[model samples]
Target: MRFFWSTLSAIFVKDIVTELRSRQVLPTMIVLGMLIVWVLRMASEAILTSKAVMGPVALWISFLFSGLLVQERSFAAEQQHDCIYGLLLAPIDQGTIYLSKLLANTAMLCIFEIIIVPVVLVAFRLGPDTRWPALAGVLLLGNIGISSVGTLFSAVVRVSRARSSLLSVLVLVVLMPMMIPATFALLTVFGAVPETLQGTGALSFIGSFNAAVGYMIAFDAVFVVACWLLFGFAIKE
Candidate 1:
């Protein structure tokens, strides 16, 4: 038990230190995210003057693609130097490796959100009425959803030359339920519409915010457990 926890910590720390030193994943995420935010800002002013409505959609677009960027490269880095195979040669279980990847990806996404969400808030002119705490909560859940499924699918396609494409499809399909609601709820909390009209027209309908939050938490949890069980098959040569 002690060894498992320690190994997990080491793996997580390794990813953090390497990323910090190299400045790969997060830089791309921030630059690309900023670009998306800027484009959205221009579009909002030029096309739709309504800040509330467009903010949510634009935010989702940024979040989804930026996350894809993270996941695609997460394992590719390992495979590049054949480091993942070295890790596999060790005594650690595949589940632990999966969790490490999941944790690292989730942590990176949280950090990205910390930086990007504020930019998003300012860009959309979301004022004092915006529920910062609630919005942060949603972003946290959304990260978990992305990381849970992403880790498994990343491992599944890690050996493929077209890994980026394959992982994108698997992730988007599994994640659609959670991301759609999280987006709508985020927009709602930012004053896109009243609670009564949570998923109405002109709004990408999923369901109520509270309900969406509850479901996504469960949804992510289930996938994490499934991935933990299934990752071994995905990892083997």
Candidate 2:
């Protein structure tokens, strides 16, 4: 038990230290996040004002792609040196490796979220009446779901010919179904429509959507384990 925790901790720390020295993951996330935020905020201004209405969707879109950037960075670096194969040669379980990478990606996303969300709040002019906490939780949770699926898929795609193009196609296609909950949460956060017209059901819908994905966490765990088990077969080609 302690060994597992220690091993996980070591993996996480090593990834963090490597990234810090390179300063690769977080900076790119921040720059891309800022660019997305800037463009979206500018573009949306004519059509929207309420943060509750524009904020959630905008934030998710920004964060989602930013996360993809991190996913790419995480693997691309290791691939450059062929270090990924060395990790595979170690005695650790494949699932542990998946979890470690997932956690690292999640951590990077959270950091970027913290930095970018404030800009979103300011740019969108969110109101005091808005449900900030609920919005934040929804974004964070939905992102976890996206990142989990993304990390696994990214790993699979990175080894293919036309890796970058193939990865983009695969990820974008797979992401569509997952975007529904995130959309619901964003709509609820923006709350742009009048109460009498917007329907009170958005909150319930968002909550239920979040809960649904939250339930999928266990499924994600299992899925990643399966992916880990199969990864060796795929990579051996």
lDDT at position 4, candidate 1: 88
Give the Cα lDDT of each candidate: 0.83, 0.69
Best by TM-score: 1
Q: Write down the TM-score of every candidate.
A: 0.92, 0.82
Model 2 residue pairs with clashes: 52-189, 52-190, 52-191, 53-190
Supply every candidate's count of residue pairs whose N, Cα or C atoms clash at under 3 angstroms: 0, 4
**RMSD (Cα, Å) of model 2:** 3.7
Q: Quick one: RMSD of model 1?
A: 2.1
How much is the lDDT of residue 46 in candidate 1?
Answer: 88
Model 1 TM-score, 2 decimals? 0.92
Candidate 1, residues 1-237: lDDT per residue as tens digits?
998899889999999898999998899999999999999899888885678877777777888888988888778889998998798999888899999989999998888988987798888877527477887788788888888888888888889998988998999998876776676677677777665453446443555667767777888889899999999998898
Model 1 CA deviation exceeding 4 Å by range: 128-130, 198-207
> Which residues of candidate 2, in runs, are more than 4 Å off?
48-51, 127-130, 193-237
